[model samples]
Target: MRIYLKGLRIYATIPRIKDANKLAKYYTETNKELGIDVTLDKISAKEFIKTAIVNFNSMKEFHFGIYTKNHKFIGLFSIIQPNYSKRICEIGYWIAKKYREKKYGEDAIKIITDFAFKTLKMKKIFAFVNTNNKASIRLLKSAQFKKTHTSLKSATAFEKTGTHISTYVLHLAIYSDTKV
Candidate 1:
């Protein structure tokens, strides 16, 4: 099954094989420093697309391609490792370099968070963000996700040994209270 979720400036939907080339190109062009836990080695675009398809079909992760109202491919947003019994899940996302800082990420987060709580019946949705990514930190906070804690973790390609990763959570109650 595929999902099509809409927001003010963008919409998210499951990726098709036709989208693989574009998505792969975006992955190759994007700077690795965009996210702290970004992949260290670049995978061939087709291979990455294949993996995305496998994950989606296997129910391993819910991957959505973020696009503009006019159908411009912007980036990706995902629900990771959902725990139905516990009513919880994790989220991860990234925007193309040119699309950053324009509130697209904020809108995507809100859309996916709403889906998790309302459609998927999740009680909590959380994110693990690199502490050094100020833009992401700000975006999450603006979406009303509370900072639970920060911890140092293994280095990523762009980070040093003691990189700090912060965990943020948005419970259904908080989302309900702030949702308009």
Candidate 2:
């Protein structure tokens, strides 16, 4: 699936082995500052592809790559499994090192949120951001996502490192007659 915006294009990552390594490498490299071990050195392209197909076919998660007008790979956007009965989903995204602070995240989020409500028929969209991630907080606000809490649950798996987060929420009704 491809979703176009004024200055960006977001498309689903093909579930092929080649695409998997490319994405995995991009992710690990881009998020290096977070002390994550996700690296090209750790997993072979073959292994990455195997994992990618399994996750891709699970139907519980979705990963989309973001690109420029020229199709330069910049980053990613994702909509994980939703509470289907409630029509609510969690949205997350990131831009490459060079693309930050340029409103790319804002534009991409706006476009995806629009698509989620209009095409996917979602009722609500939620985002979890680290409190220290001021850029993301601002990006979500620009997209009209209301800050629902001052402290959100930790995203890291159960190590319980005191990483405080903030929860943001946006409902479809807010954009009933709007286009981004």
Candidate 3:
């Protein structure tokens, strides 16, 4: 996957082994700030690099690093195919601590969504955000993702407080081609 979308003060490109060190550093720092346990040990970083390489080399998916024009890493965004025949993919992303509320997330989402619909030829894309993550909800809505359905008791194990999450699904057909 080539670098796409160069404006909006941010650009995104596929992750590489060269990026592993930086990614690991970013993850460790962000996790600490978010009060989440840092799960990517040295072995885990190795495995993550291998998996990311495989996914990119095989054209199986695109995992992008959101970076400034100066090449400073800000966040990550990815589109993943759960199964081959499903013709469906899920979008996931996170911004660096200092980059939040800077519109980088919105820009990255627009770029990735365009890639999903045009380059990947995907029919549907969805995002499952925690119900309590109001920032994410606002971003998704601003990106034109509609509320399709909610899964009660969803994401119980992922949260520290064991909160239920709602799954928000959006069809690309309904989304307008806008800057977001």
Please name the candidate that would achieve the greatest lDDT relative to the true structure: 1
Q: Among these predicted structures, which one has the highest TM-score? A: 1
Better of 1 and 2 by TM-score: 1
What range of 10 consecutive residues in model 2 has the weakest lDDT sum?
151-160
Candidate lDDT values, in order? 0.76, 0.65, 0.71
Q: Record all residue pairs in model 1 with backbone atoms less than 3 Å apart, i.e. clashing.
A: none
What TM-score does structure 1 among the candidates reach? 0.82
- Tens digit of per-residue lDDT, candidate 1, span 112-133: 8988898889998888776787
In candidate 3, stretches whose alpha carbon ends up further than 4 angstroms from where it belongs are 1-7, 16-18, 31-38, 41-43, 82-84, 150-160, 176-180
Q: Write the per-residue lDDT of candidate 2 for residues 66-179, one digit (tens) a residue.
A: 666665667777766555678887887778777777767776787778767866688888888777778878888888888775233433312225676678889887767455
* lDDT sort, best first: 1, 3, 2
Q: Estimated TM-score per prediction?
A: 0.82, 0.74, 0.80
Shift of residue 51 alpha carbon in model 1, Å: 4.8
Q: Is candidate 2 or candidate 3 better by TM-score?
A: 3
Against the hidden true structure, what lDDT does model 2 obtain? 0.65
